[model samples]
Structures are given as C-alpha cells and as structure tokens.
Target chain A: MAGNREFANRRLHSLLGVIPLGIFVIQHLVVNHYATNGVESFNKAANFMGGLPFRIFLETFIIFLPLAYHAIYGIYIAFTAKNNVGRYSYFRNWMFMLQRLTGIITLIFVAWHLWETRIAAARGSDVNFDMMSNILDNPFMVAFYIIGIVSTTFHFANGLWSFAVTWGLTISPRAQRITTYVTMVIFVALSYVGISAILAFV
Target chain B: MAENKNVRFIITRQDNPDSAPYQVEFVLPYRPNMNVISALMEIRRNPVQANGDKTAPITWDMNCLEEVCGACSMVINGKPRQACTALVDQLEQPIRLEPMRTFPVIRDLQVDRSRMFDSLKKVKAWIPIDGTYDLGPGPRMPERKRQWAYELSKCMTCGVCLEACPNVNSSSDYIGPQPLSQVRLFNAHPTGAMNAPERLNAIMGDGGIASCGMSQNCVQSCPKGIPLTTSIAALNRDTTIQSFRNFFGSDR
Candidate 1:
C-alpha cells in the first residue's frame, strides 16, 4: 500500500504533463500560427477562442488545475530531490536536472505570459496584432519571449517522451528511442511555429 | 585537570518509528585505533550527554564489525557509509550520525532495509536449482565473466545507493541500484539465465529501471564500487530485448 502511494503519485505527475498541458501547448501553437495570415485573421482566431462558451469554467478546470498540481508538486520534488549531475554528468542525469530547471522557468514564464495576455484580454484590453507587436517590439521582451517559448517547447517535447514511458506506452529501448526521435521532431516543429509567430509580430 | 582527548558525536535519535527524531551530543574518550562503531559502543555504555545530562542510549544495528555486513550503514557527517568502517582518525570532529532515510527508520540509527530485500525478491535475484537428484556441477563461467560477476555479487544489500538516489525518495517507488545490479549478476549465470526473462520483465515497470533518474550517485555511493549505473544501462538493453520477445512470442 505504501509502495502504491509512491507509484500512484509518480503516475499522476506524469499523466498531468501530457493530458491537458501537452494538449494545450499544441493547441496554443496552432492558434498562434494564425498570425502568419494577417493581424485581422489572428485577432479573429483569438477572439473566437476567447468567445467560446464556458470559457472561464473550461480554462479553470482543464488548464489551471493541472498546471497548479504539476507546478506545485514539481517544486516539492525539486526541493526534496538531489542533483548529482556535477559529479556523474551522464546524459540522462543532465536531462533529469534540466527537466526540473526548465519546469521552474516555464512555470514563471507561463504565469507572467498568461497574466500579460489572457488577463489583459479578459479585462477588456485590446488583444490584437498591434498589442502583440508592440509587446515584442522591445528587444528585451522579444528575447524573454524567445527564451520562454523555447523552454516551453522543450518541456512539452521531453514531457511527451517521459509520459509514454510512465504510462507503459513505450516499454522497450527501441520504442523509447523511436519515441525520442518522434518527440524531437515535435520539438522542432513546435519551435518553428513559436518562432514564426514571434517573427510575424516583428 | 588532566588533558582529555575525546571525540564529539552529534547523533539523530528517535524513540520509535512514530516519534519525531532529535539530535543529542556525546563526547567519548578518544581511543586509539577506534572506528565510529567503537565510539557508538562507548556512548551506549555510558548513555550520557555532553551537557552532563543522562539520556537514553543511542541505538543502531551492527554485525561482523567489518564492512561486510553492511548493517551499520548511516549518514556520517552528511555522507552515507558503513559506520563500522568510519575511522575516527580519518574523520573530522563532531561526527554526525543519522539513519539512512531511504528506508523507514526503525529507531535512532537503525532503518528497515526490507525494501531492498523485497525488491530482490521482486526481481527473483537468484538461480533456481533442481532438488533431490545430485546434479552435476553447473556450467563454468569464463574467468573474465567471473571477475566482474564477483564484484556485483559483493553487494550486501546496503541501502546507501538508495539513499543517494534522487529517484528513490520517500515518495518514489524506484527499486534502486542494488537490486538492478544483482539482476545483471544473476542473469549472467548459466542456470540463472533460464529465469532472465522473468527478471527482465520485473524491472520493466513503474518502480523498475524506468524510475531511474540517472543521477549516477549509486555508482559513487556503493561501498563495493559496483558499476551500478552500468548494470542499469545493461538491464535497460536486456529489458528492451525482453519486451521484444514478449511482443513477437520469441525468446531470442
């Protein structure tokens, strides 16, 4: 029973990563890709998502709950766990440490980005191409967004690979290796979409 | 007053498994050629604190007195090791002792290492033998194979590796380095190879090799210097093959 607690907790942590978080990441990237069309088109797409029925309830339940659990539990793990990458420095060891670090950076970035965009839009502020372009006009802001997006992309990609392993979807090394390649491709594609959207604003 | 040379100890103590742990200081008369175990024994004999108050005797597990038993593993000045082998001369003053929390603490410095034994059972870390009839000697391992297998065989079920592993925490079910390395050892044997598939399949689960975060701490923490991470990597490959065997209904 004690063992099951640990197992269940770990499974829950891994499950939360891919379900709403990974799904939301893909959806977000796709929505942002509308920027490539034009300012009007991007605004219309954004407005459509914003104008969806039960937006508050859906966002609260689907996005916020999982995000809160993952971030808070992740922070607890980061505190309790030890990192020996300084001595061992194995590839997987480094990745393990990097996952925690990126999670932290992503948490902060997500909070700030959501506040600057979503909350503003909710509070009746103009959330169009002009607003995004103006925000990205600052070299510092552009750099910050780039770093945030890259970290988010890495987190989602690596997260998917771990999710498959955690859920027993990829049990063998060959399967895991194939999953890694696939996730790497997803990472590249997602990065392209994210950077392209940023560039569209510029 | 005569000059008295003594060793100071800061030991974490708990009355029972449910009680909160606390630290108490003891200053034992420094004896030449003494180890941490000897110091602990001295403190047990006296059961007095450095502040001149009588306290309950500190409790810890030990056997064989040498490093072989691995029953005396504890955190010595923040590093986990066999307390029996921690020489006083080599250690700094005010040595700190705490139970390895990787397992459930049973008392002051004693922890229940049943988790490791349970994992060994889970992996079936043994070679099955035919009974009743006098079977001929088992197949001989090549000298090269025997050499490394001997190292893996030296594991005394010490919980140090688990203590050092970030993945095998209070909330994690990671069946840590010791049992995984033993899998490699047993699987390499001729008769043991018959059960290799079962062992490999055992480690392919939640608490198995998948839970390893690859900290490499196990390799460093192992007193016998066993290549734990190496074994885990090897087991990863073996389990991959085992999974394929399961998939295709072939044992190749």
Candidate 2:
C-alpha cells in the first residue's frame, strides 16, 4: 500500500514539472525579445528587473524556483522513465523523442548562457544594454541562439497544442482543429518575436 | 459485371525497428460482407501473397475479437483505427495492412506497448483498493461528474493515440496521450480522487506531460475518439495549481 502511494507521488511530481517549466520557457522567450532592442536595452532590462518587488518575487518563485524544481525533477523523471522504444510509428513519435532530447540540450544551453551573461552582472561591471546584441553578433552564439530558439519553439508549441487538450480547452474534433490552429499561430508569434530579436543583432 | 475477381491488398511490412520496411501485395477471394479483420483472417489462414507464393503467416495481434477491447487497432488505407470496425465493403482496394509504426514491432504488426502500460503505472492510474474491508460503499459521486468519468472510462489501452502522437516514439520518453488521459480519468473519480495529487505528480515527471509536443494526431486518430487533448489541458491547469501549492509550501 505504501509502495503504491509512493509510486503515485512520483507520477504527480513529473506531471507538475512540465507546466512551470513550460511557462518559464515562454516567459524567457518573451523576455529575450529585449535583446532585439540592442545590447544596452537587454542588459538594462535585466538589471531593471531586479528592482520591482513582485518582479523580484516572480524571479525567485516563478523564474528560478519553478525552473529549478522543474529541471531537477525533470532529471529525476527522465532517469526513472522506461526506455519506451518502438511503441509508435507516428512522425510525431520521432518529434516527441526529439522534443525531450532537445529540452535537455536547451536546459544546458540556458545554464551556460546565464553563467556567461547574467551571472557576470553580479561583479558590478559597466552596464551594456547591448550585451545580448553583442552575443548574437558572434557567429557561434548566433548559431547556438538559432538552434536554441528553434528547438525551444518546437518543443513549446507542440507541448502547448497538447496542453490545450490536457486543460480541457479542446474537447472534440472541431475543438482540436481550432486548438491546432491556435497553437500554430502561437508558435509562429513566439518564433517571430524570438527571431526578430536575434536578427536585430545580426 | 459477373465478377471483378482480384482482391488487391497493399501491406506495409517491417522486419525490425531499424530495418527498411517494404510493401507486399496479396489477393483474397472476395467474400460477401467481409470486414478488414475478416479479410486479415483469410490472409492469415492462407498465409499467401498475391503472387500465389506461400509465405509467413501475416503477423498481427487481437484479443476479445471485438472493437470493445480495442486490441485490433491498425492502419487501414491511410487512417489509424481499429481494424475490427473497418468493413471491406466501405474500403477501396488494394486494401492496406500496416503495423502502426508509432510502436516497435515485436514481429510484424505486433509492437511493444509496455511503455504505455508503464506510463499508467507511473501515474498511479488506478484507485487504491487493496480490499482490507468493505469500506462502506466508498464515496458517492454526483450524476454529472459520474457521466464525465464514464467518458474517461472508455480508454481500452489501445495505444492508437500514442501511435498517433508525435511525441511518443522509440526516441522519446514522452509516455504519450493514453496514459496522460488515464491520469485525468482516475483523478476525476471520487474514490480515485484520493490519489489525484499522486496521478498529477506522475505526469509531471520525466517524459511526463512536458514532453508532449502535441501534434494533435492522437486526438484525431483515437478510434474511441476520447478527448485526449482535453485531459492533457486539464492536467496543465492541475499541475500549474500544484506548482503554486508547492511554491507556497501548502498541502491544502
């Protein structure tokens, strides 16, 4: 009985890990839009974000807390999950596997990115609002950013389309079609915003 | 027309997951009122291809022999659906019989579904009744709520949805739509709701709900047409609220 309960707990934890992480991914993409305005603008925006109380709280809770919990728990989920191979023939299955694999890649990318950029701000260096722009100005970073954006966008968009189903917003075939279109639009919009920012630096 | 004699079949066969799958042709005697499953039965009984060559018995899996069990799902023509429900009269030849590639083939059409089963286990997709005592009829459910729960009860673990899902394949750990939907179903039950938190937690884990790159194919392909995406959407909200609870450190 206890064992079953423990098993149940693990399941719910994994389910919870997706949502905040998903929302965080969106929030980060939206925030990255600041980079399009120039390095100074991006840097200034990051710094200015430290000022507001709710923003600070959000950073701590919404941004950092959920992100950390989601990631750590995510790792736990990955290790525990079975190697479910050959269960599907759908192209989406390949993409599904791709989504999970890319998530890990993107997660690592974000950590390195923060270590290089935002964490550097702790040392009281001169504010460069265009620092984000400067990074994109580099070819390697540009490639990394592009790959990151594409993978993140694909992961989120697909996940969001499913999320619509999970949340009961799309209940039937008609609703599913509408939700698919909506998800497609959202993916395009988010991509547009993300790509527009990155292109500004180029 | 006295008779249009040839029963043309286009079958997609794979020897292994990594193998290059190929198509083969077969012809069966046109029997009156034949169904896809019935046609398959004839092919299996004869084990012959269109060229009159005796070959391996065409491989597939079914139990209960009825659509109610959902065990005989496969792609007919171009659609992922239950073969038992596919009537030959309605189908255009050459009829197609392909393994749902969304899964790994154990032989021909039989693919391993341990993953979907494991997902249900991971999410604790069941009510906890070990039978210590009667427990006095358990908990009561309202009629409307019971009706909704009834809809969720239709899942036969067919895995057509997982096969249809873009996220659940050999390369990914995303448990796919059926398990996630089961979580929603069990969580909604009055007796089952006791473990709702645990069910939510399961989906939140690795290859959990986050892994769903929802292409909406599962929703479209489901034979029972279970509102899969709907379950996923509800899970999103439930998990989000769960996150807030975790954030505030509240059990309530």
Candidate with maximal DockQ? 1
**Model 1: per-residue lDDT, tens digit, B96-183?**
9999977889999999999889999998998989789987798888899889889899999979988878788866667888999999
**What shift in Å separates residue A119 of candidate 2 from its native position after superposition?**
18
Task: Tell me the spans in candidate 1 whose CA falls farther than 4 Å from its real position.
Answer: A1-95, A107-132, A138-140, A149-202, B1-3
> Residue A91 CA error for candidate 2 (Å)?
15
Q: Report the number of the highest-lDDT candidate.
A: 1
Fnat of each prediction, in sequence? 0.20, 0.19
Who wins the TM-score comparison? 1
Q: lDDT for every model?
A: 0.82, 0.70
DockQ each candidate and list the results: 0.16, 0.14
Off by over 4 Å in 2: A1-202, B14-22
